[model samples]
Each structure stands twice: as structure tokens, then as C-alpha cells.
Target: MSEKVANTFDGRLIFLMLSILLNVFFNALTVSTNMGSAVWTASAVNLAHLFNLSLGNTLFLEGVIVAIVNLILLGQFDYFRLFRNLIFIVPYSYLLAWFKQLFFAMGIPFLPIGWRFVLDLVGLTGVAVAVSLYQRANVVLHPNDDLPFILRFRFLHGSPCWSQWDSNIPPIAIIVVTAILTHQLFAVNIGTILNFVMQGYIIGWADQHIFPQLHHHLDFKSTLH
Candidate 1:
């Protein structure tokens, strides 16, 4: 590759790594507060409970399915994208687990409800910031995040709110089904509600404010070949 392309690649890689850390950390913070989690995360937890599986394993399974769905959304196969999406979840799951443990050890879970609520909002905002960073970077992404990214730019006229709300449908179904089967719900709380309602708008704001110059780098047609 030319020097310019190599530099661009390095820059995106840095963004990808930073975004991954921020995503994991904030997600762990939200869950630690026990206020709720992202809908997809809540669904994964519910499924984990229903099937007696680990959350990490459940997340991996969910990601692989979503990655395949992304291919369908693209209307063609891009093996590299699929592979990268799948690979992303493996480390993501482990890192999330680690961060949650670390946060729990830090007494985040034992905080009073009032403080936890504040942290929950902060955590959600951080998640949105991280998501916007990597999505604009156009490198590898967690399949769940990629789903919304695809919807945002590809089908929703670049409306992050609409795409995020649309992306919630599948996980909402999963959560509902898991509730019916298990007679219980996991991680569906105030934070989950906030995430469902506010996350998209937060992402839109972050796009403009967090890294203003980091424009989206992906081209729809170019990736197909």
C-alpha cells in the first residue's frame, strides 16, 4: 500500500482500539450500576439466562447471526467484513467481562440508586461517543454496532436516531421472547429504557462534537467487490 493508505489504516486502527476500550468500559459501567444495559446486551443476558449459557458465549452467538444478517442487508458477501465482524465479538466479550468485574470490584454496583442513575447516563453517553468514533472510522465493528451503522448510512438517509430505533426491533423481540420463555427478564431497567430512547440522539450529537473531523470512510458500493 502507498504511504497515504498505510497512514490512513494506522489512524483507523487507533480509533478502532480506542473505541473498543471505551465501548467495553462504558458498557461495564452501565451494567454495574444495575440501572440497565443496551437493548442488545440485555437481550443477550436474557438469552443467556434462558439457555443457561454464559453471557460471552451468548454474545458471540448473537454477533455471528447479526454478521450474517449484515451480509443480507448488503445484498452480497464480503468475507473480510464478515470475518472481521465475527472476530470483533470474541475479544469484545472477554474485555467486557473483565471491565465489569473491575468495576464491580471498584464498588460501582454498591452505590446508592441515585448515584447509579447518574453513572448510567454517563455510561450511555460514553458508549454513544465510542460508537460514533469507530463507525466514522469505518474499520471493523462489533456486529451489533455494524447493524445500526449499515442502517444509518445505507437506508435511513444518515439519520442516526431512526436507524438506532429501527435496530432495536430485533433485540426487543428477542427480549420479549426470552421473557415469555423464562418468566423473567435480565438487564431491562431504567438504563435500558434510556438507551432505547436516547442513545440514537446521543450518537448524533457525538458525531458532531466528539471527533468533528473524523468523517465516515466507508463507501457502500466499493466494499462489495
Candidate 2:
């Protein structure tokens, strides 16, 4: 390949690697938090297993159901494009469950239910910070991030100021509604609202700090010219 083409390919690979590392690092931190929301995702997998659903199938179904609801509420489907990000989420979910199982296997005492809930709060905050930083990078966002952008662009019709905070609403709403419905259907609440609040602040902070730095680093203004 030509030098330019080679560089383009290299850039894509670097972005993908960066994405995976960021996800894995945050996920590890989240698991360490031993939070309710983090544990809840593991519980979902366990429940699916009890019913004979393979891990892959369960993740796919969950994504599909959530994506559908998001599309319905936002009255737009562009968020479907974000499914590409699921390429990472599926594997990451399984790894998280495996990590939980490993802890059990190692005879690590489980946290009390109350402590787990507190951990959930911490984990949610961690997620918010991680996602906000990732978004500010303006690199390829996770599937979850893409949903909010799609909704903002489609529903707000480009009118809303496209800061990070304004862009996060759609994804946060989707998670909240999904958690509610999932609770109703399965009799298990996942505490998505709290997750949104914690993560939302992280996003806001990232927009304020990380995005500007990335813009300056990229010389984005020069690219526009």
C-alpha cells in the first residue's frame, strides 16, 4: 500500500486497540468496585445461563431489545449504526462474567448486599468518567455513545448545542427505560437511573476537559480548512 494508505490503516488499528484497552481497563475498575450495577450485568448472564441461553445469544438479545426501545422512543433509527461498537461489548460482557466467576472460584468473600449497592454507585461514576473521556476523544465511540448522538441529531434536528452533556441524554434515557422494563419483566431492578446520573457527570466533566485537548492535538481547525 501507499504510505498514506498505510498510515490510514495504522490509524484505524490504533483507534481500535485504544478502544479495547480503554474498555477493558474501565471494566476491570468497574468489577473491582463490586457495585450492584456491575454485579447486575453478571447476574443477567447467570440468569440467562439458567435458562440455557448461551452468552453470545443473551448479549445479542439484550442489545437488540434495548436498541429497539431506543429507536421507538427517539423516533429514529440511525442509532442502529452504533451496533458496530457491540463488537467490543459482547466480548467484554463475557469477560466480566468470567472475572466474577473467577472471584467466586478463588473463594473471595462476596461483599454484603448493602456494600454491593454502594459499589454500584462507585462503578456508575467510573463508567461515566470513562465514557465521557472516550467521547471527548471524538474517536470511534462505543455503541452506547453513538445512540445518544444519533438521537440528538435526529430528534433535536441539529438545533441543540452539540456539547457532550446535550449529546448524552438519549443514551441515558434509553438505559433508564430499559432498566425499568427489564425490572418489570424479570422482577429484577438494575438501577439504571443511578448509573445514568453518575456516568452523566463524568461525561460533562470530560467534555469540559478532554475534548478541547483532543481538538488542539488534532489541529482540527487545520483539517477543516
Candidate 3:
């Protein structure tokens, strides 16, 4: 189909919904692999442990923090953007829990380390592909995901790799500080390093190949309205 057709309102909604499922499904797969989780999620888990907070609450707080950062990055305040950014997490969290349970029933936890790493690779690639699709759709996004989308188009000269790296710095810092405070680390391993190094490249590749017909339709002004 045409880029215009794929990005129409209905088309965008489809992309948004599919991307959400892929995001949570693969993210849950990654967690079930026990290889490591996304940097942001891992950081949230660490903070949850450090502060004795539930992971869900810690994640919600992190989303709010990122949403505020998004506003600052845009150089304006948009309550709708902030509200939707936070609201997206409510359903997203439930889906994640459900997917995690699905994986548990499938016995992902019992997989061999070699096979688990392989699943982690699939999960990482799936996540990159999903993010690429939804970001181009430019409908709605997790605030954390939106941060990189903003950097990719607005500031990083459309470099997904650089934007991803830039967006990851804060969470990396959080992980470091949490490690210092806790004297231990969790949800970080070879897979984590691979995700950190490779997610942008994978996303960049997906943008070019996965849905070559679909293109970025970034509408920052409209989003503010």
C-alpha cells in the first residue's frame, strides 16, 4: 500500500495497537529469558528494590518523569501529551503482566541459557521493529519511547542510533546509582549490553526494510494541540 494509505488515521491506529502488543510481548519474552530487560525497565526494577516500592508504581513514576522531560524537550507544556503519555501505561502494564504470564505457562523460564539468549535476540529485534512502526505512525507512544522519537527527528538529524543512545543516558545513570546503593545488580547481562548497543541499529534497519512504504509523519505541533 501507499505511505499515505498506511499512515491514515485508521492505519495508524492499527499500527499503534499492533506495536503495543509487540512491545509488551517481546519485552515480556526478554524478561522471561532472564538475560536482561530493557534499560529503562531494568532501572525501574532496581529502583523498586532500592526504595521498597512496587515495580508498577516505580514504572509509573518513571513515566511521569519522562513525560515532563518530553515537555521540556519540546520547549512547551502540553497537558494532553503529558496525560496521554501517562495514561498509556495503565493498559500497557496490564498487557505486560498478561504476556509475562503467558510466557511463564510456555515454560520460557526453563529454557537452556543458550536458547534463552536466542529468545532475547528475537525479543530485542521485535522491540526494535515495533518501535520503528509506532514511532513512524506518530499516533501515541509511551513517553519513554517518545523521547527517542523526538530526538531522532528533531535533534539527532534522524539518527535512530544516536537518539536511542541519548535517551538511554538517564536510565543508565539510574542503574549505576542504584547499583552503588544496593551493592548488587539485577536484570543486566550480556543481553542488556547487546540491547544497549544494538537496538538503534536494529530500529534503523527496520525503518528501511521492515515497512519501507511507511515513513515518519512526525507532527509535533499537532501533538501539542
Candidate 4:
């Protein structure tokens, strides 16, 4: 008998693919609320507002920055990797806009303050859970998430606080800085703070319980051999 080992390339790209749609969907839900959005989105959206660009345009540009950072971090430029990042991410930004339009056309409706708060949580949950699922797959990461994921592991290991922070410094810093900028412009609200406070905890929880199982399951011997 032979010991079973995990596959380096698991067949979970499908999960990643699904995560894209889920992410955009939740982004739409959050944005349409007028309550604010995830820190990342708040930053992007505020950037868009500043430059008079659409949120989609802001995301597209941000994705490019993320791709460039990924390349630099890898210490070399790979055409295939660059192509993969652009092909998927450029369109993903537009898809987020599309979903926003779709949801808008469908009418998200005017809700009371309490219900709006609830809606914000729902949107955040969808984004958090979607992020968790694809992160567990541990394959190709989306540019939006890649930087934080990379830095967290590189620097913040073994701290008692790591789990609550999993990807601590980068995201927290991003959220804080962006929160300041967006709030200064009055482009942010409680939704932004809540997501900033909660996302790390949710991702950490998912990493502890969800990631191990998905990794184990996806780690079966490579079927390509």
C-alpha cells in the first residue's frame, strides 16, 4: 500500500470560479444599500467617486495594481500568469457592475434602518463566506485577495492573534486607511466599519474549520498522472 498525498493542483478551480460570481453578487448587494461596503470596495468606490469613474473602473484599475504587485512579489514576470490575471480580473470588475445594475433594476427596495443593517450583514456574509471557500481551495487566488493572503503568511505567523487576523496587517491597514479617506469624503458608513471589524474573524473561522477539510479533500492524488 502507498500513502496518499495531496495534489499540488487540486481540481477546485471550479470553486474559485463560483466564488467570483458570489463575490460580485455580494458586492452588488452591499453597494446598492447606500450603507457602504467592504473596506476594499469602500476604497475602490471612493476612488471612483473621486475620479468620477464607475466602481467597475476603479476595480479594474485596482486589479491591475494587484497583478503587478503579484508579479513583483514573485520576482519575475510570467506571461501566462499575467494573462490569467488580466483575462479574469478585468472582466470581473465589469461583472460586478453588471450585477449591481441587475440588482438595481430588480429593485433592492427601501428598507427601514434596522433592515438596512441586516441587509448589510447579509451582503458581508456572502462575501466573507465566498472568500473562505475559495481560499480553502488554496489554488489560484484572486488579485483582490492575493496580496493580503501572501503578506499574512509571510510575516504574521505563530502569533496568538494570528487566527483572528489570519491576514492581519495588510487588510487591517487597508481598511483603516481607506476608512479614513472614504469617511473624510463622507463616502463611508457603519457598513464599512462592521466589515472591517468582522472580516478577519470570519476568514479565520473559515480557515480553522473549512479550509482544512477542503484542503484534505482536494489533496487527493493528482488525476492527471
Best-fitting candidate, measured by lDDT?
1
List TM-score per model, in order.
Answer: 0.92, 0.54, 0.92, 0.76
Candidate 1 Cα outliers beyond 4 Å, as residue runs: 1-7, 220-225
Tens digit per residue, CA lDDT, model 2, 90-165 = 7655655565456445543266766655655555655555554444333444444545545544665532134334
Q: What local distance difference test score does each model get?
A: 0.86, 0.47, 0.83, 0.65
Per-residue lDDT over 55-166 for candidate 3, one digit per residue giving the tens place of the 0 to 100 score: 6677778888898999999999988778768777776666776787789899998999999999988998898898998888777788889999888888989899999999
Off-target runs (Cα >4 Å) in candidate 3 are 220-225
Which scores greater on lDDT, model 2 or model 4? 4
Clashing pairs in 2: 35-119, 35-120, 128-199
| lDDT (10s digit) by residue, model 1, range 99-214 | 88898899998999999999988998899899998887777889999999999888999899999999999999999999999889877898999899999999889888876766
Off by over 4 Å in 4: 1-10, 78-80, 158-187, 208-212, 216-225
Clashing residue pairs, candidate 1?
none
| Candidate 1: worst-modelled 10 consecutive residues by lDDT | 1-10
Q: What are the per-model numbers of colliding residue pairs? A: 0, 3, 0, 0
Provide C-alpha RMSD values for all models, in order: 3.2, 7.2, 2.1, 4.9
Model 4, poorest ten-residue lDDT window?
1-10
Model 4: per-residue lDDT, tens digit, 1-225? 111232234346666677778888887788777676876676677677656788788888878887788778767886665675677676579988888788668667366667767777898878877777665554555676655554555455522234334433444465466547656532257877777678767766665765344542222234335
What's model 2's TM-score? 0.54
